[model samples]
Target chain A: MTQTPVTDSAVNPQVAAAPVAVDVPMMRLHVKILRFNPETDKKAHWVTYDMEAQPGDRMVDVLNEIKWYKETGLAFRRSCQHGICGSDAMLINGRNRLACKTLVRDVAKDGGTVTVEPIRGLKVEKDLLVDMEPFFDAYRAIMPYFIHPTPFPAKEQYQSEANAEKMAHSSNCILCACCTTSCPIFWVNGSYIGPAALVQAHRFIFDTRDEAKQQRLGVVNQNTGVWRCRTAYNCTEACPRGIPITQLIEEVKREVMFGQS
Target chain B: MYKGREGQWAFLLHRISGLAILVYLLLHVFSIGSMIFGEPFYMKIHNTYDFVLFRLGLVAVVAAVVYHAFNGLRIILMDFTSIGVSVQRQAWYGVLGITALATLYALIKLIPRIAGGY
Candidate 1:
């Protein structure tokens, strides 16, 4: 191999012009939040914050980043980081979704702003946390606990696989109240016992082990009970666990209307 | 009863009011259906509704109608489009609150008429 001598200007050239630095785009997120102070403000207001966000970041992550790193007064509820706990359900942009499950990139897809607010209908405790008592009240009113018929046998109470499959969907309720909150019927009347309770009631109504079907049906037969559901299908649409809430409610309505098993 | 967060309650109330309206409508239809039996039977049934219990039922039905109709419009907006769900709580509160005030005014005006002031 032969080596050739190179010129200084050709070899150096100001160290190749400082290696022409290439700029990589950093992730940026703009969150416009609805803020209200029950103690100080007479009305709610919109507040926007700029955030540094990554592609995998969930809405809950952005909210925490804003609270811990930017604003200390931000308020919202989140129990389990995973979607199972159902504690972080909120309005992201405009739809009802669990904050922990929503990706910030998807929410800001249009290069537009992202908006966060408390779930609708309940009283706001602060910025993002709203009172959740009414939801549970409706849940409890349906007598959700299982009421077994006759004494338990020495062996495990058996259900055919088909029967078990029949009740499987309604049994998946996490008591998240997401379905109940999304229901339009529940939105108009607080006393309607809502879909969650109706779904719970249906769980036991179809159970061969449960003997209190009539009693349970009677509770829901009131002026503000299963009869209220219009089958809007919003509950089914909003359910994170994919529970068929409207189907169960319709079944319960049938049982109540017909007074059958 | 669980307080069920704010949005949950609004949703619950919407369902309740909707059901109330439905029940009231059924009763109204049944009551009016008696007209097919001729005016005498209809008049008899209509006259029975002059009692205080019936009047109270009317008031409830009216309130339910007002709430359901107003809240229903709100729900229609929320469900049919993308704009209303974010402010759903506010829209619900706004509709029901205004409807309640209007219902109160209507009741105040109606009571005098029903009480034989006319």
Candidate 2:
């Protein structure tokens, strides 16, 4: 690679002439988003916006462009712009994904048309934000915490590598609601505890030290529990964290059917 | 639809086939149960089933039953074993292949009946 020597004018603060960099390619994207305001609109509708965006931009970036300069009234949630916060999950191009994780180049076509919608099986509160209380309520019902009959060790409870490995895969759940909302069963029956809850339950249920395994099993063994999973595998495909949700749910189902070995 | 993959298609076909089998079962029960009323009534229903279209529909019902039975076993394997879960997508294709072959075999056997209108 050849380096160009910088002139004094380029480095001087008071310089009037300096070369500007505009070599980056920007593609025009047509974003169609679902819009609804309870206080204003009587029903939900879709609105499209055409704007210039980089092909490498994330879906969240395009939404940011629309919210920042195009339409300020747009409502959505995003705390950590990355995928870890478990927020900003939405239906992007007919699949559940984190806006922060999905890139424009992946979903956009030659014409650059992308459709965004709120995750299903929940009340859409605004344009992209849905009521998360029901999702959280299900997670709570699963008792997504460690419990042991004996008192804690003075330093820390010992867990073998093998024991930790059993629950390690299920521990990746960020509670993003991606898996739960993508479920076809949950779409029809809201009472179903859903995949996210099962993932959470699996996280603790498999723990060797958790004494509440039986109680937790009783909670998920209900009619609205693991049995509702029709094995559509949509949750597995939609999961941004790539957790084997269907497999874990199957394990939980087995545990419920024949007592854990 | 969220553009689900093979598992989604499998679940969908399973549901459809199960329903198709149920419909066939109900029709079969009603037609066969007519024997209690009289031989003529039973014969009349049986004769109606001999129509070319009904015979062709029977082939579809058989296909549905075959697909449902095999897919039910696949689902059972998936529920009980990790190997089944790993190979579910492949097993789905296998189920389709088996259903197609079974349907073809049924069609070949029934071709004489369907053509002769017996």
Model 2 chain B: ten consecutive residues of lowest lDDT:
B109-118
Model 2 scores a C-alpha lDDT of 0.88
Least accurate stretch of 10 residues (summed lDDT) in model 2 chain A? A1-10
Native contacts conserved, per model: 0.00, 0.89
Cα deviation of B79, candidate 2, in Å: 0.9
Report the C-alpha displacement of residue A26, candidate 2, in angstroms. Answer: 1.6
Candidate 1 error regions (>4 Å): A1-26, A259-261, B1-118
Give lDDT tens digits, candidate 2, residues A1-261. Answer: 001135533644353332333564666778999999999999999999986666667898788767755688999998798899989999999999999999888998646789999999999999999999999999999998887778877897788999999899899999999999998889999999999999999999999888899999999999988999999999999999999999999999999989843
Distance from true location, Cα of A95 in model 1, Å: 1.5
lDDT of each: 0.73, 0.88
- For the predicted complex of model 2, DockQ is 0.76
Q: What are the models' TM-scores?
A: 0.62, 0.91
> C-alpha displacement of B61 in model 2, angstroms?
0.9
